[model samples]
Each structure stands twice: as C-alpha cells, then as structure tokens.
Target: MIENIISALFFLAGISLSLYSVFMRYVMGGSQSWATEIFTMMLVWAIFIGFSTALRDDKHVSIDILYDRVGPGMKKVCELVTLIFGIAFSLFFIWTGIDMVSTAYAQEIRTIDAGFPIWINYLIMPIAGVLLFIRFVEKAYRFFLKKEIPTEKEAGSEWQL
Candidate 1:
C-alpha cells in the first residue's frame, strides 16, 4: 500500500511537471531549459517504482491460459517457475545497473540542462531491481512454504448473469 502511494505520487509529479513545462513554453512564451530534463527524470523514477509496485500487488501482465487449465499441483509448479525467472532476471538487472551507475559516477557525467549527476537518474534501476527481487522472494515463500492459495477475492469476483 505504501509502495503504491509513493509510486502514484511520483507519477502525478511527473504529469504535473510536464503540464507546467507545456504551460511555460506556450502561455509564458518561454520555458526553463531544465524543465524537460527534470520531467524526464521524474518519469524514469515513476516507471521503475511503478514496476516494483505492480509486482508487489501481483499486477504484472501474464497469459494465464495454461495456468487456468492446470491442476493445483501443476499450478504451483508453474508459479515456482515464474518466480525463479523473475528472480534471475531481477538479479541480472541489478548487477548491470550497478555497473552502469558506477561508470557514470566515475566519469562525472551530468545531465545536459541541470548538470545534475547522471548517476542519480540511473539510480532507480538498481532500486527497482532490488524491490522486484525482494517481492519475488516473498511471493515464492508464500506460494511454496506457506501453501497459500489465492482466494476468490484476491482473484477478483466473477460475474453472474
């Protein structure tokens, strides 16, 4: 819930910044050069944070044809496989993201308009990767060890005609 709130705030901030930038450029007849870069940074942070929030809520997109057709045991196996894939990919993302950020920091790279350190912008990659990794671990524990099953409420209510 907290993650969702933070992600929403970042998303709204990005939209607000974009709208303000447009207003300044058109209505005010000029715009601060840093506005676009700041907006872009906000958008990047929002996207990565949103990814983690979605994973935490089990809202990530997936095709469930096979999962729906499978038995309970098979479904559990499928979920385990999916979680393994997610963990592996997230670890890779974290590793590479750290390397990229380190390189940027070492080179003293800065943003074009604001001259802010580029590494700060790239920082979200690792943060999101860590969040995703932790979420996947939590899910795997609940699914395998806890023997928990998704309730109808969690799955969503079905329509009765």
Candidate 2:
C-alpha cells in the first residue's frame, strides 16, 4: 500500500515537472533546462516502478486465448509455466540492472543538465525487478497451496482496503 502511494506521488511529480517545463518554455518564453532533465529522470523512475505495480495488479498485457480454453488442471499448469517465466525474466533484469547501476556509480556518471548522479535513475530497475519477483512468488504460493489464482478484479482491488 505504501509503495503504491509512493509510486503515485512519483508519477504525479513527474507530470507536474513536465508541465512546468513546457509552461516555462512556451508561455514564459524561457528555458528551464534542469526542469526537463529532472522530469526525465523522474519519468524513468515512474516507469520502472509502474512495471511492478502493473504486474501485481495483473494489468500487464497478456493473451488469454489458450488459457481461456484450458481446463482447471491445465490452467494450473499454464499458471506455473507463466510464473516460472516471469520469475526468470525478472531475475535477468535484476542481475543486469545491478551491474549497470554499479558501473554508472563507479564511473561517477551524472545527468547532463541536473548533474545528478546517473545511478539514482538506474537504481529503479533492480528495485522494480525485486518487487516483480516477490509478486510472482506470492502468486506461485497461492496457486500451489490454495489452488487459487487471482482474477483480474481481485488483483485490481488489492489496494482498495
């Protein structure tokens, strides 16, 4: 719940910064170079954070043609396969992301306009990957132990409480 709120706030801040940048450029006839760069960094963070949120809510794009036609037993099999694939994919990102962020930090990389440490933006990749991995684990547990899978509605309603 707290993570979701943080993600939302991050997204809102990005949007606000972008709009302010545009207003400064067009309406005020002035350039705010740092504003755009900062907004870009914020956008990167928001997108990475959004990936886990979407995965948790089952909002990620998926084709259900075969899944819909399968029986309950087959559905379970498919669910397992899907979970395995998701876990593997997320792990790959986590591994690569850590290396990328480390390299950026070691090199003392900085953004062009804001001069902020580039590793800060890259850090989101590994963080989001871990979040995604955790969500996959939860789904796998529910499927195996409870023989239940979350429906789209149930997934979306997780934050309602």
Candidate 3:
C-alpha cells in the first residue's frame, strides 16, 4: 500500500514537472530561470523515486546474455554478485548524498531566481538515497526469503515499447 502511494506520487510529480518544463519553454514568453531550476530538481526527485520503484520490482537494467547462456546455478551466483555490487553502490550514494546535502544546508545557498533555497534541491539526493537503500534491502530480503517478488511485468506491464 505504501509502495503504491509512493509510486503514484512519483509518477504524478514527474509528469507535472515535465509538463511545467515544456510550458516554460513554449508557452512562457521568457526563459524563466526558476522554472528550469525547479524542473531540474523535480526531475532528479522523479528519477530517484522511480528508481526506487524499479528496485522494488527488480526492474533495473542488466545484461542477461550471460545469465541466459549460463546454467541456473551460475546465474544464481551472478545474481548474488550483482546484488552485492548494487548494495555497495547504493551505500556509496547514500553516504555521498548525505555529505552533499549537509554542505548545501550549511552553505544556505539559494537559486539565482526566486531566491529558492538550493538546499531544497540538494535534499532530493539524500531523500532518494535513503529510499533507494530501503528498496535495496527489501529486494535483498525477498530474494533470499524465497518470497514472491514484484517485477517489471507486474509493475509496468502496461508499458509498451
């Protein structure tokens, strides 16, 4: 239920921000700096939040050639290795994101337009990092526990390309 809500929020926000960007470019007469800044921050938030959803559903992109050719046991080992790498990457992102947000907060920098606090934009990194971390843990747990895990098929089956 919580996952559903988060997914919906990310989806809506992403769509709205994207539309705003388009509007700023076409509809708005002048190139408003604030619009771009806000849109960029929202875009980052949307991407990270969407990535969290992807993590939950095991929808992250990967090269499946080796897995397809190799036997199931080898594939399992590869999966384990990939999981370890993913966890490490996520931890690194979290640490860096925290450091970045901290610096931004301490500096109290604001955007050139509208005097928007830059820290608000920087906040997205840490927030997304935490969300990604949680999603990775949840995925790891489900993988090991032999529980039913969400997949791209379940979460994004409607998408056709």
**Per-candidate local distance difference test:** 0.84, 0.86, 0.73
Residue-level lDDT tens digits of model 3 in 1-161: 45556656765775786677678778975565566666666566667777777777667787787689998889778877877887888888878888887898898888887688887777776677778778777767877996867565675655556
lDDT by residue (47-125, candidate 2, tens digit) is 7888877877778899999889989999878888999999998899899899999999999999988899999888988
Q: Model 2, 56: alpha-carbon shift in Å?
A: 1.8
lDDT of model number 2: 0.86
What pairs collide in candidate 2? none
Overall local distance difference test of candidate 3? 0.73
lDDT of 1: 0.84
The candidate that achieves the highest TM-score relative to the unseen native structure: 2
Summing lDDT over every window of 10 consecutive residues in candidate 2, give the lowest-scoring window: 147-156
How far is 64's C-alpha from truth in model 3 (Å)? 0.5
Supply candidate 1's per-residue lDDT for 7.
Answer: 77
Encode model 1's per-residue lDDT on 38-103: one tens digit a residue.
888888888898887678666779898888998999987887888999999899989988998999
* Model 1 pairs in collision: none
Model 3 earns a TM-score of 0.78
